[model samples]
Target: MSSLPPVTWLQAFEAAARTLSFTRAGEELAVSQSAISQRIRLLEDRLGQALFIRHPRSLSLTEAGQAWLPSIQEAFERLAQGTAEVFGPEPDAPVLIRATPAVQQYWLAPRLCALHRAHPELALRVVTGVWTQDFVGEDVDIEIRYGQGEWPEMVRESLGEERMTPLCTPAMAERLTTPAELAGTTLLHAAGFAVGWPAWLAAAGVEEIERDTHRLWCDTQVMTLRLAAHGCGVALAHRRLMGSAETLVAPFDIECHTAEGFWLTRPARRSLREPARRVWEWLADQTGEQWP
Candidate 1:
């Protein structure tokens, strides 16, 4: 009676096209692989055009399928949006954003309050990981990663330049008046960074120190900064990740202006929902404000 195929066929086509694997689409849609394949076969037959070029172990969209996918995706997005507008937003619907543990604990943790105050209507859920930028999962909408901004398969937007400096408690700052005085206090080391006590000491014009200058090693910069804040030792950390050192002080004017950077990124080729787009822009605008 109607002039079109069933919505299920279109859904099957969309899912299969997105995942490029019938088994994965079936997993996402909670159906069998055979069922997904059958629906797509029916869809192609109904439209009188081949939708996929199926190989022994994989699938790729044909020209027709590629052109028609955007309409289906948009239709589904609008339907969900309209349903929410007519009724109410889902209780658990929040924009999922991911950042590394150090960024979450230091940089982003301090500014979340301002973001929430500005957009109380938007719900944000934050998750942390130490993986590289290209490793974000499929469901995450936005990500803030720390590196040289060179990850593949994603576009990175800069958050301005950040530099590394020595951070210590107020008392330690008093004791560390000169580069030569570093021998009196413990030296905190955050492993895996190119710049450390050696480079910083060199910048401060001190070649070497005594072997007994107390030292502490840590796997993460967040932990190193926390230890410094608690009067354990002095930590050399980035300007952006200076939250844990709120009560701490920079003992010297010396800083390491390395090639390292922080970036805001999202998966390539994915269209952002309205809420996710707002948060992304907000994060970019945060660079202009005073950061702790």
Candidate 2:
């Protein structure tokens, strides 16, 4: 063939050949029967071959139409497949979690296995830092902060209250049974934490002990807990931060109510994305605690 027929003419020919009726093809293509007949005639004139046999009562495909039918159907099928592959069923977006090191290490890290099992399609990104992050310029979708749940412009929910108590290795706890015993023994301290040896000692009714001397100090609860679990000293620890770590024990029954607590916060202006919502709900389920 010198030149191929136009696409509309080919489509009309294909439809008319498949149905063997110009009226049925017209109904399928949302065109009039005369329009289908005219286009098929034009296609035949272009190809110099009769594509359909016309009968007064019915219609049938010509030899040439029968030959071309398979190719046209296969072409349409390939286009549909390619289109679906290019634009269908997008992958899930990654949920970003920003948290303090203690929460990231103790609480969130341990519960991630359950989250992954629950939401297998969700991708997770965890970023840890010292302070509560502002979401205005950050990519965080969820944030866990250790403080009073009072972020002014953010949507804040309390995970739980952070009650501090003295924790040590099981061996150390075996020797010291009373709150008074914590004063004379080695006391571990987390640097810059509001709930420290001083506050805990006061709560335990042992305020006369030296606050400055014979203490092990670290920058984070992660480090402090590790040191205390390894028989360094009794460290002031948040209850949730223990997270089924069986190596540590609370020696004294007295607990101090700290001004700080763990909070789950997000930006108030924007709604959470799908992945973020899954992670948020997963965190709530894992903790079995939530605040209004």
Instruction: Give candidate 1 misplaced runs (Cα > 4 Å).
Output: 1-92, 131-134, 210-212
- Model 2 agreement with the true structure over 146-178: per-residue lDDT tens digits: 777777867787776668877888898898877
Taken over the whole model, the C-alpha lDDT of each candidate is 0.79, 0.75
In candidate 1, the residue pairs with backbone N, CA or C atoms under 3 Å apart (3 or more residues apart, or in different chains) clash, namely none
Model 1 lDDT tens row, 147-248: 788877666787777788889889889987887888867888987676677877777777577364788899788888889889998888887565556787
RMSD of each: 10.0, 16.3
TM-score of each: 0.65, 0.63
Candidate 2 regions exceeding 4 Å error are 1-93, 132-137, 211-213, 286-292
What TM-score does structure 1 among the candidates reach? 0.65
For model 2, state the Cα shift of residue 260 in Å: 1.4
